[model samples]
Target: MVDAYLSLGSNIGERETQLQLAIEQLNMTPGIRVKRVSLIYETKPVGYVDQPDFLNLCVSIETNLPPFQLLQACLEIETRLHRVRKERWGPRTIDIDILLYGKSIIEDEHLSIPHPRMSERAFVMIPLNDIASDVIEPRSNKLIRTLVQPDDSVVKYK
Candidate 1:
């Protein structure tokens, strides 16, 4: 199985429940096994600023599926959870992003591993550091822990 990391966030409906159910869905998928999950953090919205605060967390999974298939599974889970794509970085019931896929570097028309912007987002970095601090981020060749700094905008969710 290949080790992969995912970041999940929700700002609509029961936020925490959304995150939990997403975790359950991921675990139930055929080739994916949810391993470690970081503590949920409540963070301010990034792109569109006017939405409700989001509940964010990162997850580590072992999956036999390839990167594209893994991405498909995440999208399927989001659709099942009622995520709507109405705007760029818009609010949603749940958002699942594939952050890393076993040191793989992929740049396709539909997907980008290492998530392109993950290093710049505190919401993704903080929680990711919780579980995979020592994992090397291929692009920067630096530890996940060293690439991030605590931000005032992200706080531990209850």
Candidate 2:
């Protein structure tokens, strides 16, 4: 099984419930095991600030699925949670991103591993640091702890 990290966020109705449900669903998926989860955090929206603040957390899992398959699984979870991708960075019921997939470097038209923007987002980094601070960026080969953004928006919500 490949170790993977995922970022979960919600900015719309019942945000906390959405996040918790997503975690439960991910755990129920075959070939996927949810191992560790960071405390939920509240952060201002990154790209689009006009929307509501987001509740975010990071989860570590072990999965046997390939990258695309993993992406598909995330998409499925979003769909089930009533996510509507009407606009880029728009408010949603839930958003799940594959932050890292073991040590593999993947670049494809549909998805990219090591999540291209993870290092720059405090929401992603703060929670990630909770579970895997030693994880190395596949492209830069730097430990995640060194790449943590100095933004003050991310804070433990619980």
On lDDT, the candidate that comes out on top is: 1
Encode model 2's per-residue lDDT on 81-152: one tens digit a residue.
Answer: 999999999999999999999999899889998899988889999999989999897889999899987777
Q: Give the runs in model 1 whose Cα sits over 4 Å from its true position.
A: none
lDDT of 2 at 95: 99
lDDT by residue (34-127, candidate 1, tens digit) is 9999999999898899999999999999999999999999999999999999999899999999999999999999999989999989999999
Q: State every prediction's TM-score relative to the real structure.
A: 0.98, 0.97
RMSD in Å for model 1 = 0.6
User: Of the candidates shown, which would achieve the greatest TM-score relative to the real structure?
Assistant: 1
The lDDT of each candidate is 0.96, 0.93
Model 2 misplacement above 4 A: none
